[model samples]
Target: MSRWLPWAVGLVAAVLALGPALGPGYVLRYDMVFVPDLSLPTVLRGADGFPRAIPSDAVVAALSWVLPGDAVQSAALAAVFVVGAAGAARLMPSPAAAVVAGAAYVWNPFVAERLLLGQWAMLLGYAGLPWVVGAARGPLAGVVRSLIPAAVGGFSSVVLTALTAGPVALWGRGGLRRGGLLAGALVVVSLPWLVPALTAGAAGATTDPAGVEAFAPRADTPLGTAGSLFLLGGVWNAHAVPAGYGDPVAVALRLALCLAAVAGWAWWLYRDRPGFGPGLTAAAVLGFGVALLGATEPGRGVLAWLIGLWPGFGPLRDGQLYVAPLALVQALGLGAAALWLSRPAGGTADGPGDGGAGAAGRGAGEPGSSAEPGPAGPGGRRAHGVGRIAGVAAAAGLAVLPVVALPGLLWGAQGALAPAEYPRDWLAAQAAVAADDRPGAVLVLPWSAYRGIDWSGGPAVVLDPATRLFDRRTVWNDDLVVGTPDGGTVVVRGEDGLAREAAAVLGPDPRTGLPESLDAAGLAALGVRYVAVSAPVDNRFWSDVDGFSVVVEGPEMTLLEVLAGPINTEEADISGLEVTCGLVTVGAIIWSVARSGSSLGFQRTGVERRPGARKEIP
Candidate 1:
């Protein structure tokens, strides 16, 4: 019964955070980034064959077949909180501490901000870190248990999990065996994203200065930075910051709460003396330092240098991501503190103490001078009373920070999965595109790669909706360029820009139409059979365009047919390689899951370290 309580609390918090946005239509953020490319075949092929870590996308796509896409997203969102709490609890010394830690992790400002940003893929890694830590603590069986979740988490998340688990796996004698097993499992699980990334030479393109700056932590001071991260509010986008972001009162209260939690955890670490406490502390500091380093010019410069040297390092540009591990470590520390305060007057004989006869009793050491055993035996009400008071204080400290910092989180920022209806004409336009039996591509007018959407009310700039507006194959303009050694940026279009060169011939002015820019012959040469415009445009853009006829003229948009375009059906030799790699990735995960008997349980409860476990600090 105690085991279920923390999960119950976490579930309720997660539901409250996402309750309003659970709808039938795709949410603004989900549709903007994920919906456009939600097809299974597309995932198998890899997103533009550039290794953008589409495994999570592929899994979500596969799940959509069995469940409604909206339901799958809701479940995934809820799992972030549920798994986070469960894993955190496994590392904690007591149930009370676990409950508090779980709530603190799930309801904090960082989780709230990322949720609002609609970065589900990155969050998946955040959710999986605790389990990774548990599995890496030394046991071949544990590594086997960690594969399924790691695979489902996608590539970026797997990397985050590795950061947390690697330190633990590398400590003590014979650590190499356990660590090697863990690393091999991670590699196998990450193949879906890793394989494509290696094959497609565009991995370096992902780490742009713009992306680095976009998610960097923005705080006034070091203390402020730590406080904001503790409350989960380090996102660089000003508009996306938590409610009451820069208010003096809110800021002060948040810092106070963070200080209290950290101080409380430190006190608990001193008293409780859990074996992993020191390592967790180090991991927290390292993660915090890395995140802070990425927020400044020097950090970005360093990252830029790394990206130039190795394309795989490109994903690390978003320094804010480092905050997840720090946040996890903090949550666990807070839990340990709460549990310490609630212990009996003499402390539990089986509780985790700093090498004392408590939770770490297997190799317990002397108690601190102030922590000497009391005359009162276990279950004494007097000590319990004092402990209850301390427990309340710790929980209060952990909860207040997020509550005050992100008050509007529960009521705002949710995007509907499925609404009752879309603009009727928009639906008709999509139907027309899907109806076309031909294999030609589409050209979306106001042809750029990104724009503010109607659903999100222009709060953030997202990928162009035109890409997802049609069921037929489509093409859009390139938004990023890769840097070459010669100081020139090269535009590499993997798969999407089928008609880019031809579309380039059409001058930027859409209103000028075919006469001055492109004629019917040019349209045919580009292999573009259709064009759709969602935003308002002058009638002249379509009126004078030759070899095109109005197919569906709706109040919100216009759909045109390119009556004389030639469709190209050439296949790439590399297509077979992509499919084969995807298959092997899918098969490996399935085989591992079967071999492990589907037991992905994180059983790291209690304080018994594996025999021969090294005492060396990570």
Candidate 2:
């Protein structure tokens, strides 16, 4: 019952939070875009810049072969909540505390904002954090097994795992060796994207420093940037915040909850001295400090300098991502609070004793070895009257507090995440392109990366689905345009050299993203065989074009085929290096799993307990 309770809690939370989003079709928003029959070859071929979608999209495409794309998306989204809740819950010492921790872990502002932003891949890694923390002290195989979700999430997830759990591995026994093993595991899992990124030459290795200001953490609450960050809600994009989430009442309540959770964590650290506590505390502090770096002028300057020095520092631009470790800390702290609240007055719970050596020896989530709830003490003496009832009620109230404080996340983020089906024209356009054995790339017009589609009933801004709709490569604009709070705009330069070359030849309008006239000779020279207008256009520019034939034309999409010309018919295929690295990563993971002989879902019993072990409080 205890083992299943966390899963049940996670499912309920997922249903309540996702609501209509859990139905059919794709929930397209921001970076989240899913198409029917996503082409694995196209995903592997990737774009000119960083292979951000590499293994994530590759995995999705592989799964789409077995399941409908929509079902795959639904399962992926649901897994975020389910896996996250279960992992966080299992970290707690007591079952009741586990429930509180699990709920708090998935129901926070960080999860809400990231989900709204449609970064499901990043969320998947976030879900696996607790498991990584728990496995940090164990064998290398255990750590590799725990990293499966992060492996699927790609680069950002791997970095997050390193930030959150790396310290824990270092702080454990045989610190250096364990830390090296963890580092090796990360490198092995990161090969799919890492190999491409390293070999991408100067163009792919450098990023615009403008992203430092554009993507820095911003205040989303009346409590200001620091306070909002403390509450785990300082995402950069304003549109990503849940509806009515900034209400003053909600802000106050959330702040109070954060303070209580922090205090509870302090108490737990002092009392139980959990093995992962010191390292987790260090991670939380370091992560929070890193987040703060982007919140100030000097810090932003430093970040920009770092990015200028090397593009590898690009991830630091989005400092809000680092707050994820703090979110985990607060979640576990809330669970510790529940443990304290539910325990009988002047008596500890069933598992460990206060400041006892036995408490420090046990690993996280070692069932029956940590704490458990009851009115009785170690001596089997039960509490009577109001004391037990009060304790139970208080613990229960703490469990419900996270939901009450962040009401905006309920019911599919106030219906902002409702699913919408693709129009027939869009599907037809995709099929038309897929059926053709095209040797050249598809050029996505409007010459932009993102689109505000009306198919979702309301205009939902998402990365153009047409970019990945075809069975082959599609070249589109990759530059990012960010709107500032002061009504100004920042255009961050793109990394795709090929896209830049195409842009120079096509010369798209800055305002409309559409070309003034068709340059058929120029496009054919660039190896563009087909042009897809993914958005509704007021003017049909391709109608009178000389060197093109219309393939599919509708209100929503227009596909054009270039007429006979000297087309650069270079075939795009996955590089041998990328294939080799992917194969190696897969093999490593399989070997690690085989060596471990136990799945990540099950716990290893009879762990050797080291007595008199003490961890420093950060």
Candidate 3:
């Protein structure tokens, strides 16, 4: 209970501090466009409902049953920060060190940019890193423990965790066997998303190599990319940078802090301590290397080769995403730095209750009765001098904390800003969509999937709310859009033809009527029955639209009923595969739980004897 007190307090405090930004309204930024639609079966299935490969969608869908969809999304965001902090603490030597590292991890420029860009899906992977680290270090460590976060966060965390497990197994006794078990566990958990992702190409959801490189970290060379990796500043969207980010002073300050943090952590790593293991250092370097691969031509070639081998490997398109593991590394480094700053005049940080080697051993949960002994006394003057330099650098890092955290970062987490409230017109439009008794799809005009909805109070590109707003089946564009409202027409960055068709259907001349250019028969073939037009976009094309009548016209939306023909195409058949994967995951989980002396049906507990220990109740 005492072990949990710090975490509970920190989580509650974080929620209160962040509530204003994340409470009530729906954030309309980037992929947050889809969060509100978490309850929709079609969205959970993803992209024309052919692929149930989106693990985040599955989590949202499951939670939506118990909580409001928006609340679930909000809670999930808070959980990422909270869990990430907990994980940082779990991997650190003392509570204070953990708090510093947790703060660094959750409240950094990288986290801010991702949250602002609405990369909550990827953030889940980031949040799960600490858990992966913790599980790897525990006495009962196994493949299942190492890969459980993968079940929650998908392949991103799986790759990162696997990297961490590599050094863990390789650098320790029985390493190979343990590593193999971890790999097998990863495969089992991955079947949920991996099986569907492998088959997604057949469902027209393939990501071309060009698309894969679209969000590649932009750097002059692999070395430059590696440099940026440690700094935590390689977002694909330049606009995603924090306010005043490029200022010379800000850059220099951030760079200095980054170096200090890394140096401090490096110092701690060399110590024969029980803090974060060698695996984290190895994982950080590997993650940085992978992130750099996208920026260099040779690296891109390697990436191309990998993509060629695995079709489901498309999500790694955002090369910057690989920087996730590094963020944790930086946090750890900063935590180690903080410990150095708190050290007394002595070079050795073995003071009573100081959380140096002793705290490290306890935190690591190593099979030891007490902290390892330190040198009998302070060694020399040169040692103290070197310690002082490291302490000063750590202090500098502490200074830069606010600059990287605060609301100055691209308007401080766009998704966390006051939520966009559902307008009355949106409610009416949703009701209208719900009234359609026939099986049909609702298409929102100005057909691009990403739009700069003015209500969210920022220029961040967000997914069209219509996808979630309409309770009926939705026929919308499928592409990763990155742009601003003032930037004019939103650009379709992905190579999906359906997205291009959506742009073409909207036509070059938006002032002209939509039906004038659209073939009603063609649309009928796709099962589109109604079109909802939101404000600020030209709807003159609808004035001359034939065979359709305005069903509901509100301040925010104009719904038009399609009168032409019945849609002919068969609904996609994905239920069988979705069900199969769900059943397999559930079965595995149930079996694992049962083997652990637990039951989902009722409260049942059992304990067995361990070697050199007495038998427990069963």
Superposed on all Cα atoms, model 1 deviates from the true structure by an RMSD in Å of 5.9
Residues 384-458 of candidate 1 have per-residue lDDT tens digits of 567656766755565545655556566434432222234567667778777767666667766555555565433
Candidate 1 vs candidate 2, TM-score winner? 2
Best by TM-score: 2
Output the number of the lDDT-best candidate: 2
Q: What lDDT, from 0 to 1, does candidate 1 have?
A: 0.60
Candidate 3, TM-score vs. the true structure?
Answer: 0.79
* Better by TM-score, candidate 3 or 2: 2
lDDT of 2 by residue, 259-371 (tens): 98999999877766677788889999999999999999999999999999988899999999999999999998998888777765544542442212234445323543443
Q: What lDDT score is found at residue 275 in candidate 2?
A: 73
TM-score of each: 0.81, 0.93, 0.79
